[model samples]
Target: MTQAQQLREAILAAPLETSNFGETPQPGTLYLPLSHLKALRLDAHVVVGGRGVGKSFWTAALQSEPLRRLLGLAASELKGMEVHAGFSIAEHIDNYPNADVFDAFLAEGGDPYDLWRAVVLRWIARQAGKIIPHDSWPHTVAWLKQNPEDVARLMQQPRNWKGLILFDALDRTSADWRRMDSIVQGLLRTTLWLKAYPGLYAKVFLRDDQAERTVFNFTDASKLTATKAELKWARHDLHGLLWQRLINAPDTHGEILRDICRSTQQENVWHVAPEMKSESDPQRKAFETLAGPWMGRDKRRGVPYTWSVSHLSDGRGQTSPRSFLAAIRQAAEDSLERYPSHEYALHYESIKRGIQKASEIRVQEMAEDYPWVPKTLAVLSGMNVPMDFDIVREKWENAPAGALEGNPTRLPAQHIDRGWDGVREDLQRLGLLETKKDGRIDMPDLYRVGFGLGRKGGVKPKG
Candidate 1:
């Protein structure tokens, strides 16, 4: 059979959970059953990370398995339990009246606190299991005016329903810092309001950088820290995922898959070694090569490599099994298409090419939309200095004198209101930039490796 057919058959034999990745499952995504909700009760948790780091997939997985297991009911069961799950409505306010009211509250503008009050009351009334009189808007407003204290008192009452409200895809919202901040604040407040109700829960998924910038306020660290879930992939966990997929492939395909894993590891190590010393040495060298150059070395000059052949290539340290599986599947498919005869060796090359292609697509697509995109990417691509807002702005402002002016480039900062902020947001969204704890930003190793950039210290200046 053709290599693609063989690989497909192998994947088919694997368990559904074993072979899928990211938010939407495909043939090779890894299913990690992380039961984190067991530690949380009566409060919301924020799951945040870079794209393809498995935030949404983890959220979906959490909601799919442990959520149902913990709550003892499916989504349908909670459908009538006075819950609402959706993305932020800040972007849609002008079009949707109900959304407009929430948007106004988020913006913290308007003298009509009563208008805001009426909106909340109506929303509560519309929630599942809520029984409010079907009065006109004016009538509802009139009633609230007279019973303001009563309405406030009712809101204070502890909710006793069992339901969860999930809000995802916040990253897709417009890149307006003020609007983004307001939305997160409004959501947090909404979560607090829901928390007062014993039976209600709210969950939001966001990127780690976005969450740091928008959600985690120093003044409210207690509130923010109390409800945070960070997504991270351990090396062993990633390895388990790869093994699971290989095992799931159909028998013959499974053998080939296993052989590929073994051969890739062996060849990668052997290709790098000056001389073979021991079996463990080959495994170590193989992992180091797969991990790329961005990984840190110890003070004593020892390299620390976490991923194995079974692990995903996380040049940026943000990849999850989903991204890994997606890359692998795409590589395999591309190989099948290009070199129909030499599927074996071609598939390996396809994996490497697929990674490079994915990174290029991310950069190119951003460049196509934002004028400054190419400059931003070029600045990132030609990394002679550490990257941050100031450096980016300096480079952008002085582009006429720099090497990039003659290139086909557009500056996104020129078109967007907050150009620097916009470029940073775009880069972060595309997984090219990551925020460190000290507020510094850096590229993921995957991007650096795919672009042929050297890692820290070991890298030399190139012309």
Candidate 2:
């Protein structure tokens, strides 16, 4: 095999699956974006971000002792802090209530606030070795509600260690938005309730849509909202993460890639230099080593370093690391198969094809999250964006009666009662569609290509 083929092999070994990738990311695959530092701090009560932006990743990473120690290098407050999952995708009936327990409790006219408080109280009870009701969730909640003084004494008692409680994947707690909103609001109230104790901290991971709801309408909601941190990845941060993973590939592959990128190894993990973490000449030169200088025969085609990411951004000007890394991996595979003899591991043409592959994967993730999204967006598949809203609304209205039917068991179509306008707003909020200054609708190439939408002078969707 030639050098390009070998490099492709090295790139293939990096983690590409983002959505359903295992909860605990291996230590070697870790990369910290400067923008995410505040979100990882103990005091940030609410962390919000788009899908595939590392909310779930951090939820699991914070639980690992080794990962916490590594993250501590950047945020010293995380060192030696006890982390526990109060409510997460990884459901533990003993630690917290599951969907069924929540459903049953709420069905019986139980308050979600008391249930969440019970979750924290149980964690503290275990730590303090005080026996309460261990039989079931309802039993625990009943005990807490029945004994106010006992709960207050346990909460106010000082301890030598500080604890961090995490809550994520809250959408799984309920299907309907109204119920989900109530549950979320209750959790926030409980998070505010946690503030009274100096030794305990609460961190809640929420999606942007969830944050925009009435969950924060309750008393003292601003206390948690004030400490909100958004999880974002900058352009250089994406490249930094790419090199971080590239340099840590298995065995000889790691040695070769690390040598090309010129990364630093410390504590048995590779890191991109500070200069490489920005759009410096060094960062450009590093990517050029693998994909070459220009995206085409000359500079007229634009630089591969910037073109690759710019093409993958959504309409909101946000590009998830999941999209970027997935595109690179696909590009490497395409280059190896179609242009093994090419001078670089990632050919310009192959990079374009990588965007197509990444878009397809992203659409699949959307389907899993909101099954109604694919069906609704399918109507505009062949149409071009940046067109007038009336035309799009006409298309939506002209579709079959069953086309827009929503699944209430999942996240139902947002604001369906308001008709096509509501759907338009929902899509815009999701970074899938944007309204131009003239009120024309726009879709980003990240979703446009996969969803089979057209844009003038843009990457064409597959026939």
lDDT of each: 0.47, 0.87
Best by lDDT: 2
| lDDT tens digits, residue span 1-463, model 1 | 7654565445445543322122433323333323333222335456665545555554454444433333332233443344333443233332112433444444555223344345455555555345544344345656777876767765655555555656555634434445555556555555555555665566766755567664555355467467676666555444445444554465566566554444222211111111221234444443333332322233253333332222233334545555555554555566667755652422444555555555554444344434354554565554532445577567666665554332222222322456567657656665566676666666654455334444465323223
| Per-residue alpha-carbon lDDT of candidate 2 for residues 268-356, written as tens digits (9 for 90 to 100) | 87766777778788888889888998988999998899999999998789999889999999999999889989988899999999999
True lDDT of residue 211, candidate 2? 95
Give the Å shift of residue 295 in candidate 1: 17
Per-model TM against the reference? 0.58, 0.97
